[model samples]
Target: MPPHAPRRRARTRRSIARLRSASIDAFAIWRRRLLFLVGGICVGLAAVFMAKLADAAQAAFRQILAISPLLALVVTPAGFGVAALLARTVFPNSQGSGIPQVIAARHTHDPALRHALISLRVAFGKIVVMALGLASGAAAGREGPTVQVGAAIMAAFGRLTPQRLPGLILAGGAAGVAAAFNTPLAGIVFGIEELGRTYEARTTGLIVAAIVAAGLTSLWLVGNYTYFGTTDAGLALGGSWLLVLVLGFAGGLAGGLFSRIVILFGRGLPGRAGAWIGRRPVAFAMLCGLGVALCGLASDGASYGTGYEEARAILHGDAAARLDFAPLKFAATVLSSISGIPGGLFAPSLAVGAGLGAALRDLFAEVPIGALVLIGMVSYLTGVLQAPITSFVIVTEMTQDHAMMIPLMIAALVADAASKLVCRGGLYHVLAEQILARADAPAEPVRRTA
Candidate 1:
């Protein structure tokens, strides 16, 4: 061999050796991470199961009070106050949907950490707030807080441990929702498609596991009922398909309007009354309580809670003066929602869409109310979340009716498109913007080390 060839071969060998060493180091680090993740998943799933039990307890408590909504409404503020204080004191990062927190955490581009408060206190606070909010006629749902509760439980179990990557967090998040709502596949889909923002093979497995774990937890406690008791009235075929198209169009328009109005109020109220309310949360909550109480008295306690009864009424085609009540329910719900009382918009949104759908179905007099209600659900959900596929899937899953798939797809697509045209952000995104904007406000500079 030439002298130069021998020298080049030696150089190549050293380079290859260096590469091999680097690869080995990377693998070692990855293995440790993998091990930690497996441990976190075990810990997180356990926590999720426990939280589901707590949530079940809360649900039972709410049901007991639901028998006397007026009196129950009064008790909600106390719950909210305690929850708010705990949340502020303990898991401040856990405030709101907490979807944003996990989303932010997943982004390597973002630099932040969970404090001791977020893992324990925040989750508890959310539970208290959510329960109280539900009791008090807050036009919100429990899913968001429950999701946080699950995440917090996971974080607590895995504390002092190296951070799991975004995938684990996403898995935990999915499990949280699955456990809360008793919808495992939806939870899996939500984790992979909605929250995780990917459907890769690896992510699908982790999320599916988490969802299964969560669903098992929920089924053990809550029984396997869908959140809404949607009727299985078959979808209209042939001539009725036209009605579905009409419902889809109508739902899209209504959903778009609802989305716009929420944004308008959420933004307009701010810069004016929000600061005042912030200064006097107790007073604002009291006023809200009174307003909700008065609404109950006016409607003879009809316009309260998550609108479950109203939804049933719509489903049965037994609604009387529902059109008039729709506006009131919408107003009450929107105000309660914007007031920052801990609740979920999911149920309220569903209720709103149902009311609208029922009204339209009555007007048409040809289409089945069930079909319209389902369309309305997809419409409003698509508009709010701007996730037509998720919305449609959730509605279909909730109702367990495959016949309306075509109509749902049509309505969802239109509603999402319309919402996008009118609004710059989806429901959670708008909320997230407010949250991050609040968080990202320039912190007072600390003195630098020399």
Candidate 2:
């Protein structure tokens, strides 16, 4: 027998163990990546599903209007009432824009609480209720609700593995924005500026990977296209720049007021009025629906649905947007939002901005209408979300207009300041806090259904 035989066998055993350890580690890493990739693809598909649903709903509602413009008074209120009832009873956490619920889920430590906020059930309810609202001609957007749905899907996937990654929810949300708008860069910016509030190096890969996957999926289905189309509008630093200042400040203040009203309603109205709304939320939702119907009448059906077509036309200089469309759209969006129906504010806000810009286009006839429209968009969006970078990036990506970046950035800054003057808190963050408070104080006489 050779003495070296024992040492050789030991070395072989060590090599085998090392290979096994490396294989296990590699498998785990690959599994996590696969989850993220699959989750991202799912999010993209969900975005497409949601967009198609919203489009079909709006088309159906338009047909109803063709039959009789006044029919919305009945259809809208009745539909809003049902949506509110379902949100209250069957989907307690599926009310409003759904962005708030995602934000709340991110902040919460309790797994159960987060589950309640961004669960599969809540995601399904969000889709159904949001579609119903759109079908009823409610002035709302689907983009925001898409964020919640994406987050829920990603969170559910996260639970499949023993090692839970906290940023999966955030990544999912960012991916949703990417797929919904086909704007990958804006998704990254939103994930950093709006959702996570800070850059996480570890999750950056996950975020980018998810965004790319989702964007590819959406592009494959919907084809490559900009949200607002291409524009050659530029803002030189001269007399035309003054429009930026004027429109920026005005849009910001208006956007700020919108956010303030929403927050106030979310906290419930003051005293007896609040109590009354609390007791009969479904009825109040119906009232709000009626208000939206009136806005629709005033706008000649322009204020219904997501306001996407209206905004797109105005941006492209194809439509003579009504002078009062901005304010009416604003009122309708606020009413739909406070009614506690499931819908998003992004498209309606842009519609209001487009109308506002069109209204001011006469005053600045020398300025390019596209420039004013672009400025109005950045200003108002920045004001609503209090996320300047996200707002500018999204508008830039949507319009595919790099020439307006400088003015848009400046406008966003101005809007951010003006918005803070009216409403100190960001809309989603404030709503998220209220959600947390309600969850913590469940015994309190808080109206979750509303």
Candidate 3:
């Protein structure tokens, strides 16, 4: 061949190599973006489904209650018992607030454990059992289950990419919070405070993108409404600050007691009681359901479901809730939680806080009921979660009230401190430890049925 021909051939080879490189680069970029887009879409769709399910469950419960209070009484125990049985038989590793499972998936080293904790089956079970709990008049929320659904969706999508499991879990969880509450900032804060526990530079963009996408999806469907609706009320900053202090301590004590009870029950009942409960979990769940039913009857149905309507009503200056709402809702929530069903405490906790604020309304006649409701929400949530920033931001975002930021922050801080005094660790973290312990144990063949 001629020398010129050889040089031409070399140039052609070089050009083809460059073209191939560019094509690969473009493909990689598209794949990465596609993964994110799909993940976000899944998270958003899951959030919307969770929201609808929650609403439907509550509506069903209300219909039953209206038809006959006695029917509700019969339904609650049967519903809880059947749900507990289904959770044991059909959906292993799908019980309690789903946040713990996500946390376990994020932290565990074993791949099998992570998969067991957060998977498509578990996500489906979480939604089904949570709805069942709500339909039965068991106090529960969809927000927690949404987190698991989001995490499972994102994690499953992440399998298509080179993303790490922890980042995928974190991003999905944050997206769940954002979409569920329609509070994107709070979702990011939740990622930092509860999910990640420390900001990671690598996952920041992913988390933000997922949150924005999921939040927008929720807004598109729900019309940009706040979780608790808007409030124009603000405090005068003088003696009103005293109201914040009082509310902080009161809400803290109540929230701390709640945390302590839940943690103790989660760890296991003491001695013979624990053994008995372990053996007859369904029966125990039925008894707990009875307690919830009684609480609901006592509160005239205020203690049933997620407590969202009652809390929202109080925030809007409606006096429909009774004075004993706080205690009744608290009882219902604790009982429902200990029954080992798939549900969340977010809504019920906020409701308990709102009821506490309403109860204190007699003392703070001059303060706006809306403001007090917001304070109690932040304070109690902080107490339960022990994440002051997340609690405050969630309350602020849900209320759409920037004016109460300072008071809300103060209440959260105070409540966090008080909660620490009662409970050694946050609820989710403590429960996560249990999952970790189970992961560390030797693997056993998981029975498909109870």
- Best by lDDT, which number? 2
Cα RMSD (Å) per model?
6.9, 3.6, 4.4
TM-score of each: 0.76, 0.96, 0.93
Candidate closest to the true structure, highest TM-score: 2
lDDT by residue (tens digit), candidate 3, 147-233: 998999988887776645468788899899999999999999998888778667866776788788888888888788888888987
The CA lDDT of each predicted structure is 0.61, 0.90, 0.86
> What tens-digit string does per-residue lDDT give for candidate 2 at 395-440?
9999999999999999999999999999988898889889888788
Return the lDDT, model 3, position 290.
92
lDDT of 1 by residue, 310-346 (tens): 7767766677435655556666666565454566555
Once superposed on the true structure, which residue ranges of model 2 sit more than 4 Å away at CA?
A: 1-12, 441-450
- Which ten residues in a row are the worst by lDDT in model 3? 441-450
Global CA lDDT of candidate 1, please? 0.61
